[model samples]
Target: MDHSIRLQIEEREAASLAPYATLSRETKGRFRPEEECPIRGAFQRDRDRIIHCKSFRRLKHKTQVFLAPTGDHYRTRLTHVLEVSQIARTISVALRLNGHLTEAIALGHDLGHTPFGHAGEAVLDELYPQGFRHYDQSLRVVNILEKKGEGLNLTVEVLDGIAKHSKGRREILPEDLSELPATMEGRVVRIADIIAYVNHDLDDAVRAGILSESQIPSHLQKLFGPTHSGRIGAMVHDLVVQTLKNGGEILAMTPNLLEGIAELRSFLYENVYETNRVHDDFIKAKKVLRELYEYFINKDDHWEKVIDYDETTPREQMVCDFIAGMTDRYALDLYTNIFLPKPWSVM
Candidate 1:
């Protein structure tokens, strides 16, 4: 079949996208080279691959901030990534950067997040000899874990974006750009992650009755706004406006807004993330994950059926992959089956 439409789209990208935008035609290529699609550009193809992957499906069941929150409105990992994608796309589109690459990176950024969120990750980091990081695990998911160890073979731009999307509690924007991702789309995802979580997590905290709207620092509300949509709108507007004013050479936001975001993050840490309501559940999650890890590592009679990534891989790494791959419900169910006593019943 003729593939001229793909070339036409590429030409359109070149004419319309900014000079710094990562053009789909100029992609750095995937880990394993393959023929190009007739309709989709490289980044678009990568986005499709991520969306169709098993890990992507599991995200709906994984934790974002709240651990197995009973409320329906809590942000699971799936919704968190979608929010990040939306914010990132808005920024990328405004800057004339590659929205496709930004979207692909944003969607795949949290694929490696643990079942119970950071609590599960913390447990693995302590118990595993090599330590654990969700970002690296995200790369591992796209690089080795997905497709029965064949990997997604995503483009270099997308891979770079996923690998560096996280900043933890560190600086939101460092003076050195090298510390950030290689492409502008990747950088957009990085900042968008912060934007998505701080706002949504705070919203969730309010919903969970852990924090009231009035309790949030007044300055944050004034700067970002009192409502969730207003807060996101203000932040996105600042990012686009500041970056455009700086000629789009670098992503920039007014120091006041940046500082405001940081302060809001700090408040969440002190009042929401570290508070007893959240931490108490995390404590229990930690126990369940720890015991499950030890059991699987030591007892190998039937784990392969569930975690058969590769027969050659070391059991420890395989177990780590399995645990990282589990959804909150799956992990809980497995724990209950393995550790809890069942009453005898009629046969």
Candidate 2:
């Protein structure tokens, strides 16, 4: 391949042309041939903006499985996003797709996840009678939360993919998927999300002593192969080969592959999520969150600093949002102080 084209293979085509892509499609401008390419430099800037955002940084303190402040090996949401980005970029490169776009989508995919993984999400969802979802919250983060007024103003493609990345099937419309700028790249990220979580969640479960390698059923082991690492390697390899062969179409894991992953998920749910080990912590989290919610709702002065909204906004949401944005240890400390009334003497 010529150096220009080889570089294209190495870097995402979109990154170079992101700035042009940001221009309205109807807008007219004269530029060099390369400037008018499908991918634009603005997309790269947008991805970079997301990476540097405070919310993105806070992902390091958020949970993937266990609550924050646990052991170091436990997967934080930030690490999980990086893993997904690695997997998606590998797939993108193997298939001669835009690695930058895929990686950008992967990194931004989980920006809306709550502080405590699914547990904190569940609490927020329950608190919202109208229903709350991380995907929407993620969009909110990029569109509103990043700055005081306008957001990073990312390209439509990145924004749209982040908004509908979750395959809820019901939440996304066909038009939404059709209108995406880099459909194949988005699909790579979508599948990568599942791939990263399933494999790593199992790894975390095993390390926490909630599951054993032998606990993986015999039938599953034979079909999907042994151990979490082995399964992840096989799955990623299989997907890469199949995607390259099939022109970048996402290759859904076979029934056996699906079953194996499900078994692992089920084991974690039963052994880790449902057990008293988790519930004990959850009970405390619930109490602390509720108390903090009540505290912030009643106090207008403190709410002003944490939120952009006026005092008229409901306290429950403000408190939840503030708590949701906190790093793991910060939330825990806040909870302890408010509900347990811990005294902190200021120097």
Best candidate per lDDT, number?
Answer: 1
TM for every model, in the order presented, reads: 0.98, 0.79
Model 1 lDDT at residue 243 = 94
What candidate 2 gets wrong by more than 4 Å, as runs, is 1-40, 167-182, 304-307, 310-317, 342-347
- Name the regions of candidate 1 deviating beyond 4 angstroms: 305-312
- Residues 196-262, candidate 2: write the lDDT tens digits: 8777877787788877888766776776677766777877787776545654444444455555656
Candidate achieving the largest TM-score: 1
RMSD of each: 1.1, 6.2
Question: In candidate 2, where is summed lDDT lowest over 10 consecutive residues?
Answer: 25-34
C-alpha lDDT of residue 24 in model 2: 28
